[model samples]
Target chain A: MTQPTYDSLKVGDEIPTLTTPSVSRHTLALYCGASGDHNPIHVDLDFAKKSGLDDVIAHGMLSAGYLAQMLTNWVPQSALRSFNNRFTAMTQIGDTVSCSGKIVEKFEKDDEKFVRLELYSNTPQAQTIVAEAVLVLA
Target chain B: MIDKKHIGYNFPPVTIPVEEGRLKFLAKSLGETKAIYTDPDAAKAAGYPGLLAPPTFPFMLEIDALDLVDFMSVLGETLEKLLHGEENFNYYAPIYAGDSITVRKRITDIIDKKGGALQFVISDNTFTNQHGKIVAETRTNYVFRHQ
Candidate 1:
């Protein structure tokens, strides 16, 4: 996929939206190993239930990764300047997460061209994460 | 109730060695197909020092160094009632494979809301590379429910 060059982007332009494959317990476990977050609420169903959750939940970082993937897929890896998110809600297994972003501001700082974006991730039901980021484009 | 006195507490620093193999694994787990994340040559072509750690890859280093149980214990909180509420990462510079980065964590805020039914603990972490250059700062918020 060809990414958008910095010169081609405009403030208020929407980046392409991406829908992730349904999250699974297996994927959660893999993330646990890869990310080193072994929180029982994310892996142990019984523990999650005891913690007032219906079932084991996906790691917030997993959904955050989906948002990052959406950006890196459209922008070069080197262009990423900063990424931030608020995990407002829990993501359970079997939920398909969708991510989208819009260019909100563009400017030059320190002789660098940068674009700021408002980002989000949601399940079919509601938005689960809200984020904002700045990307440097060559 | 969480101890407000611990708000300014700082944990010991942890130095982590970023490895290419680990970066590859993390990228694979995310189903990332970016060559710069998995191939050192591709990363160099992209102007990185080596295999580039994906945006969220620092979670591995941060989480490993963070002993949650100990952290919560110090605040008079329990693990079972905890949930991740928020995360923010601000990058001052790119993190590359083979970089030995040091992470220093500190509790910055504690808030009780909903008549104390929920408590939020916010922490800030600073990442410094081997040369003592500030690489990134991450702020995390954890929500704890009262039983």
Candidate 2:
């Protein structure tokens, strides 16, 4: 899995699609454990039902987590320059989500290689463009 | 209906080191067998310095940097009244291992929605290494519910 130098990338290339299962209670728990974010909305089903969501919802970071997968696969593991996104809709249990991105621009700045991406996280009922990002690679 | 005020609210930036074990654990949970996130040698083979973290990894660091937790914690919007309405991110650059990030966070927006409430915040999450190279920036949103 040798990473390609940013020198070879071009505009319009579709970044790979990374998929993760729905926002199961387990996903939130695992995410909370890994990330140390213990918001109960992501854990307690009784609490979620009370909050008006059908059941426990996934953490926004977990949904965004898939996008990170896309980047690690596309560039070198750490090649991801920056990862930022808005927490759009709440993705629930039993929903399948896909994370992907496409190269929007490419150029050299400050004598460094950089690529711009329009990233997204989509479910059957929702489509969210998490945000635009710039990745600097070697 | 309850009111969440954003006026004159902000949080001190939180700086943290990127931990490799956590990324490795996340890759496993994601069922991702990709060597880049799993193996340092593999990532090195892929042209990285070491175990490169996932792109969304910053959220873990930025999440606590927000004033929302302390804000909402005091609002009585307990998990019983909170809902995650939406999320979006703006990336500044790629994040690498051994990098420390300083994020200045605060609630920037508060809105009302049918059947729920919306709260948006700007986590001026900036990553600067010991050498002062700004590695990346992250802005995020957090939504709540109405009871």
Candidate 3:
């Protein structure tokens, strides 16, 4: 599907569903390289155990990244002004993360169409209410 | 008591280049397969000019390319103890591949959560592209180990 433009949108809309695959060692390593957030807990098993986990854990931000993927597909690419989420549970190496969003409000600001949204992320263990975001389009 | 006197305290801005390699690295890390994030052809299929960034791609160094090291340096933060409690992004537009961004960081809030799961310090960052367009707004909360 093509990325949506500023128009063709309305208030009180819901973004489509997206699923994030299970965590993997290679994926965690790649995240560290991109985010510059090389916390051993996310990639090193020994460090994770020392930190008191069952095994190497996924980066909290990476778990949230799942929501980002959902947002980009639901809204326009880069039309997303900001995407945010909260980490409520520990996403283990084998957990699945799914995401969705709902438009909370819409208003006109400075002659631009602005939409406020509530984004949600769900893990096997818990549901995390990630964040409230606002987007402005011309 | 919180003080508004320092409300406007600003961290220096840092500049960083948006590279195709970095975006691909992030997509690979998140186990993402969207063509927009990895393949220019797929992006074109999606009606984008070319390969674009994943939604959270700007959460990295691209936002800090304007000499804003202070955002990366929290005076009282310890790497051994620092934890990211939460993150929130407010989008104004899509951020794609080959886009350059600069990030300006500042302390937005700091409160002791009363020895709760974590004491929170929130920072607000603003990202501007190479064309000096305000591309995004980021607010992040850092959970410091409680004393």
- Model number with the top lDDT: 1
lDDT of 2 by residue, A1-138 (tens): 567567677898887688776656676687777766777767887777666767777776676667766776666544555555665566767778888888889888888888888888888778744756677778
Judge the docking of candidate 3 as incorrect, acceptable, medium or high.
Answer: medium
| TM-score for chain B considered on its own, for each of the candidates | 0.91, 0.76, 0.80
* Better-scoring candidate (DockQ), 2 or 3: 3
DockQ of 2: 0.45
> Model 1: per-residue lDDT, tens digit, B12-58?
99999998888888887787888998888988997788888878866
Best by DockQ: 1
Q: Which stretches of candidate 3 lie over 4 Å from their true place?
A: A2-14, A106-115, A135-138, B1-9, B41-50, B62-74, B115-117
How does each model score on lDDT?
0.85, 0.65, 0.68
Whose TM-score is greatest here?
Answer: 1
CAPRI category for model 2: acceptable
Residue B49 deviation, candidate 1, in Å? 3.7
Ranking of all candidate structures by their lDDT, best first = 1, 3, 2
| Candidate 1 docking classification | medium
**C-alpha RMSD over true interface residues, model 3:** 3.0
